[model samples]
Target: MIFSYFSRRRADRFAQLLDAPDKAEVESNASAYHHDAHDPELEKLLHLGRQLRQQMPVIGDQVRPDPDFRARLRQQLMDTAAARGIGVTATQEAEPDDAPQTTSVRRPGLRLGLAFAALAALLGLTGVSAASGDALPGEALYGVKRQTERAQLALAGSDVNRGQLHLEFARTRLAEAVAIADNPRLLPDVLDDMDEDSTAGVFLLTTAAVDRGEPSLLDAVDAFTSQQLPEVADLADTLEGEFRQRALTSLDLLNRIQDRSAELRRLLPCTSSDSAEVDDLGPLPQRCSALPATDEEESSSSENRDSGSQRGNDTPDTPDASPGQEVTPTPSDTSMPPSDGLPATPTPPSILPSPSTVPPSSDADSDDDSGFLEDLLRIIGDLLGR
Candidate 1:
């Protein structure tokens, strides 16, 4: 019971030390309390309390929250309480009204600044893209122009569309070449780019036309070459030396593209998807030796052959006449009667007869004559057929 009394007294003295306003008062009270109690536990507790009191102000300065954060935190507490179906009256009472108003006023300014920055950046890129459209090879924005074209090609829906884009870019490159014609360093490079784009575009367009069996698709290549050829020739005329040679080479390529397009159009009808021969372009057209016969031509030839056979069957076979008797010509026989004592030979039908008619020596000779006439008629029909 006596120890319990001392313990309660010690607690009361420690509580008083906590309330002390200055470090000197805390030190003075703690020394007096330690001397009266001679209690080691209470002395240790008092020393820790004194150290914490001394450090509290430093800790507060370092860990202080921003005014904006405090305002947001209070507002968040109110919002969270409202979300949970709890009364927000207590939270509202704890926070000042002006804090939320200040935050609301500041947020719009920050957002507006961010929006302006983003818009400025977008406009800057757009300006660069626009300026690059007219830029030449060594200009700063030229790479940007090429990159934009590549982006367009990436977004293209089909090879034909991409091919057309490549041709258009090639034209742009040609314009650049003309602009920099005085700059020997850049002229060759620009012309090279132009040639590359032209070749790529022609290959793509021709391949598409061959694959789809649509000769009309080659019209794009023709149009591009026709429009560019004169310009290229004029440029070649203006240039000299190696540059002139380069321009001439580009001109030749354009001519070749035009010829190739025309050839592909002529041959597209003969090509098929399963064609065996293919090049960098699509399938090569099969070389046709002869056009196929139409159904009407075949039917007419069949009818002619049948008629010739029927006529041969209708011709009557005559019995051998005596060598001493005079022979009479039949009504079907258009030839005059033979003057000599010999039998009249039957004439064959003459749809397409040989120039010289010979009397058949035997039945095999007659059959051979009929076969030769039928073959002649069929050849004529095929020649005249569609």
Candidate 2:
């Protein structure tokens, strides 16, 4: 996918030449390019080949240089060689211009390989684009640069006004990302700039997106930084001990954080930056139902704040009661009648028979049974009342 995009223009040009015999001149011009730069003539040929290949599809069989065409092309190559202060080799010693000279275009095996190449090129050239860096828009590049700057500033503990300014800058970066369309390298950073704790946000965004079989958004946050987020690491070792543990990589964490921001925003105040603090560890104890409800409270506070909704795998424990112990599902049942206006009925108690009710072994009959009736009665009464 990446190579196709980067070479699309060249591919199209090659296709055009393939379809048009008159464009043999284009092929002729390309034959002069050879791999060796030490030889001026070869150097010229290499330049022309690079230009031509860069303008044509690297992998395909749509066209071949004609034998007669190549012979004539070699003459043109020699002519160019003479003009460039390089001695032209005799046509006799040079391979036939028209022998169907071949051009080799390397094929990339995966889409990411091409994308990474494009990224490298973008970095090298200071240009970002969906394809080769040639056609990048000025405004988009400026937006990304500004976003990077703002993110750095915001992260340095700047004030709200500075944060807001950074946020606005990030918005521009997002705009640039949208414009460039296929530049995944820009996405992670763009989303990062959208929040003050860009590292966490980027990590989560990368993880979730990768799971969905797409590009990860937080590409730059290192593993160490990603682990710093409470969900992915033991922040108790730091200041976020109240939060849960996670094992996501930095990019994965950031991507996930970004996703959480949307849902969290509906329940909390502040931008994604402020929200990160809450999401990393969640709202403080007063705002969060971190404590578990006791059996009695669980029954009594089903609809109230003490409902004890643990976020993830924390399960409530069952109370230890002997085999036939009765249990109340809720505490408020005794105080409130059924909403349907049914009778304010008393709960039926469970029953447990005394050991004497069953025939005992002849030898065991001598064992103590003093507390037997008392235990039986208590268990029976509790069941019957339920």
Candidate 3:
């Protein structure tokens, strides 16, 4: 157990323990990570590892090649390539057009074997990594850089490891996207890959928690969700079209976490957990009642400011009469009052019928009226004759 880290996975686990953001995460994961129980050496080593990790950035800057060293190295590369009959042109290879073809008997297999051996030596001495600090965009080894990461992620032993690996891979994708910012064609695929990785990381973490898996895994995932996922989601918005859409799909995955979140909370309660005498640690938690409507100040919102009649919304407004029924007029539906344009026409004070309209009394009156008219006409004739 003292020398267990000779195995690659154990070494990786130790590294993860060191990578933990807080003392709680490290201590929580330590028991599962190292089975040594109480090896004083391991404890000391862990403490030393933490200190080294904190100082690594400063050391890294010190080790970087100075400008003078880089210039000399570049000049030496040109001199070497020239001596080897190599061309520096962007599109063409180094070998000259008149270079002789090897038709004679030669041990091509042996030559290939030597080439492979040298490549293996280089890879071992200087491991390929996507985060290879010097691997700028358009460099030949860039593809190999990501390939190394894929190999490592493929070997990840547990879901927790896979989840962390995927997150790292997602970060690598973001870095690559930034590196090739000008490449419209490749940018979308890169961003899509990043989103997928982030989503997968969150999914695995939540699933592990739901299954009552490792507490350390749950805690680690919780940390990432609270700290990292939001930033990645915001980064997604910077992209255009389908790339952004794929990223949105992953953001949707972040939402999926709530399905298992209760389980997560049960497994790993936060420091500020206020369970209120409710043991929510069961597989099925006690259903909490929905929160009351914002009654913080004992709200008077439902207290009416105006009377229901004043607001005119009290009873349903009287329905218009269907077909033949008499309609009752509410204030809203009443007719207008009559105007001064129409006047009363009764000029007679007596309430008597017309004389022609009378029956028996009126018949005698009509006969006398006819005789008087004939006498008046005769008088006019006599006056004329005289």
Candidate 4:
């Protein structure tokens, strides 16, 4: 019971660390804050905080305030009061008021000018941010999106928060990729960057997950894949061949990351009988029910190519011929079939008849051939009768 109480207190302490004050007193001896004894949950939280801290962007060495700043302010105040007709010696009082007048007038003007400049710069920065916030992945202002996240990470102090932030921005990148993916000129580059963002986000999430001993970030990835990725996949599926493959390739990369995490596999909703655990190099992770075709599609396509049964290759049978009737020959091109994949085997000259060998016959020629056949049959019949 006593150990449980201390663990609760430590949990409360760690909770406070989540909202740690800017000037909060941290232990000079870090060991004082770290205790080896804890339940699995508490252990996970500690590991999460540690990973988040490590993931946060390192802002360069912070410049501390000058030790004598207060003294400098005091001296400046004393000199200012002495100039404004307070505690002045008789010798100083007779001095021209023009010096102080100039100081007073110029100081206010200088301050006003600086204030205006600062306000203008702030407005400009805000405008840029607003414009960039709505920019898609391939657009020029997309760089602003990334730089903004870098600033966020620089400011974030919690590792858990930082990892989450990375995934959030990663989703934003994906949002952009999906939004502008229909534009052929823009899609390839945006998708490429989207892949990088997803890979990085997954990597960070995995690190945090391992440290925390749970796939906590899986929910976020699932949300992104469910909501945003479908559009990208749909757009890619509309394409005919290689471009479609490129889109699927990126999609698969993301799935591979998900495949490695066991918790993620259990959460996935994809279920294809063909996608069942096979001899996958990716270790045969469970799949979602709605995921697009994977290596299975590629293999199926290869089979289609090899068998030459691809679309537009059907051949019609030749029409039935009457006795002694010659049918008109169709064009060789029409007679033969369309082909794909490997070339059709060639018939050797020795075994094949020349095109001229098949003589063409008109309707008149067929009538003459039939009459001769009738006469020959009649003569044979008469000989048998005698």
Candidate 5:
């Protein structure tokens, strides 16, 4: 029993040698081979027939299978002794061999154990290969999945700012995939998903910035438009129209104001008396005539017309009331130079006569006269009243 135990332990140690570098692989093989050497544990009842053949005394006889009558007779005598008590007693009584005989018994055992260890190592390698194929690249999976989720969120709603942020993330991932993806077929889905929002966001932001005079954003405009998002195009078109009109309007106002410094100064009450130059000397009627119709006012009028149309009504097509007819001060009033350069005595109200002239011809004529004079008088009064 002791010799059998030592032999089994030696077998296990030799098996471990096949997997010297890795503990996990060796442990797995040890667990699978947990039973005894030929364990399908044999029935405890000994097969005396087989035992007798294995222990038969055949020393110096080459121990080859018996082919002669003498050998068969010798083997039968040993079996008969084992079956009857004498051979059994002798086998049990044999002195234990501690060296040469024990070593000889282990030779075949060592070879068998080495064979099993090799088989276990091969199985271990095959399992490792199988496991590695399913192992995911964690960083790549995290980054790509995050990007895909963001793209889905952006496409679902109308949140412009959030959508833009997500679109940028998706775009970065798509660019990475483009550079490294082994398969071209994988590219189109990611690209198409990314384009769904990235194109629109870039278009809107670029056009808005361009209108604000940030020329840098213009770089993205063509690509944005090329993607052909209808909503993007519509937004760009609308903003472009408003910006174009604003620029033109500003230019128009600039021109109008440029040529009308005298009029502006005249309308402003805070002008100093001595600021007037030689060119500033003029009659009030003549100064009023020089106040040309400003393009800003024309734009304002057009805007009014547009608003009125939206109300589904024709705005009265009445022409702008003409500037009031300025009546020069009588020679009597003009001859006297007042303390200020202003005309002497109150000029009759612009819309009202001295109550001495002939009345206007008809209500139509009267309405016209009143509109013109009333407007001019009101403007003049507002200026002086400032």
Candidate 6:
């Protein structure tokens, strides 16, 4: 939210305060801003600012600027200003050694020039960063892109935010790899960087999820892996040999993250992770036992058991035999033997009609069948005697 113009003005104001001729001027300027000169925080900041300003000369001495480069830069600025129809006055030559020196007046033009130079530098950096956003491996601006990512990670407000930034950078690396797919030499390294980012991101996010007992945080991990897995798999499909293996390794990492997220989701319902085991991914969630049956559930189960037992007791023990119908007797060992002393041939049992299909029989019919069986036995004995 801090605009460049506001930042520049603040920096200019601080610089003016730091460059004050004496402490009185600094106090006068501080009073203009309604800041007490004796305030502890203001004193600390001012002290630090003064210390930093004091070091500038030593820094300048250690790293001297190239005159030719400076002249070229100045000429380039003049040329640019001319192109934009702005007048840029040239610097005057130094005065004679014997000439008398007078009190120096602050040059508004010089201040304006410095401001323009700072603005130009800022714009140039902005343009480079914007261009670097899409830079691939071996490109001039790729290093800038990575540095920017590192800065973002360093400035992240929380572990979750840092994890997200890692994943975002990982996606950027993936795109870079895809852009440079033809460069086999660089592709593996890019993929390797992507994997490292993915690991760090997953670890941070998973650790946060576990420590906070918030499985919802894992949604980001799931989303990232789901989207990247297919793309990496496809890339692996198109590659061969070592490169393909490298891509497959990244794919494997994605798959592991996915499985880890799913497992965390399942475990998040557990009340505690105090006894959980730790691994490279973080703590493995402890096995959650089935919850104890609630009162309603226990009551429902008991009612069911009672109903089942009651139903069993209510069932009839024996069905009523229909009147005038003889019940078939089961065969017993007391049956008569063959008269000829030969082994009796066993008759195959016939299929019986169901009770519903049988017609009611009279008692006289049953008595006649019984007598007929005895008559058959007597005729067999008579044949044997003959």
Per-model TM values vs. the true structure: 0.43, 0.20, 0.33, 0.35, 0.19, 0.44
The candidate with the higher lDDT, 1 or 2, is: 1
Q: For candidate 5, list the clashing residue pairs, or say none.
A: none
**Residue 210 deviation, candidate 3, in Å?**
4.5
Q: Model 5 segments beyond 4 Å from truth?
A: 1-36, 40-196, 207-212, 227-386
Query: Each prediction's Cα lDDT score?
Result: 0.58, 0.33, 0.45, 0.45, 0.34, 0.57
Error of 6 at 272 (Å): 4.7
Give the worst 10-residue stretch by lDDT in candidate 2: 346-355
Candidate 1 per-residue lDDT, tens place, 48-145, comes to 88788779878786654545568988897676666544554444454574555323423355544443333332223355555677878888777667
Backbone clashes under 3 angstroms, per model = 0, 48, 0, 8, 0, 0
Worst 10 residues of 4 by lDDT: 310-319
Per-residue lDDT over 201-237 for candidate 5, one digit per residue giving the tens place of the 0 to 100 score: 4333322232232333333433333333333233223
Error of 5 at 1 (Å): 25
> In candidate 2, what are the lDDT values of residues 1-386, reduced to their tens digit?
47776377455544544444444554554453323213454335445766676576754444554455578768876765675434354444345667533332223544434433333333322223222222233443453343333223322321222323333343343344344434343434433433333422332333222222222222223332343344323321222221112112332444444333322322121111211122221221111121132234343334322322432212211122123443332343333322312211211111111122211212233332333333333333332343
Clashing pairs in 6: none
lDDT of 4 at 38: 38
Q: Which ten residues in a row have the lowest lDDT in candidate 5?
A: 276-285
Clash count for candidate 6 is 0
Can you write out model 4's per-residue Cα lDDT over 108-218, one digit (the tens) per residue?
A: 455444443333322233555456778876567666555555444433444445545655765676666567655666667766766655555554444334333344555
| TM-score of structure candidate 4 | 0.35
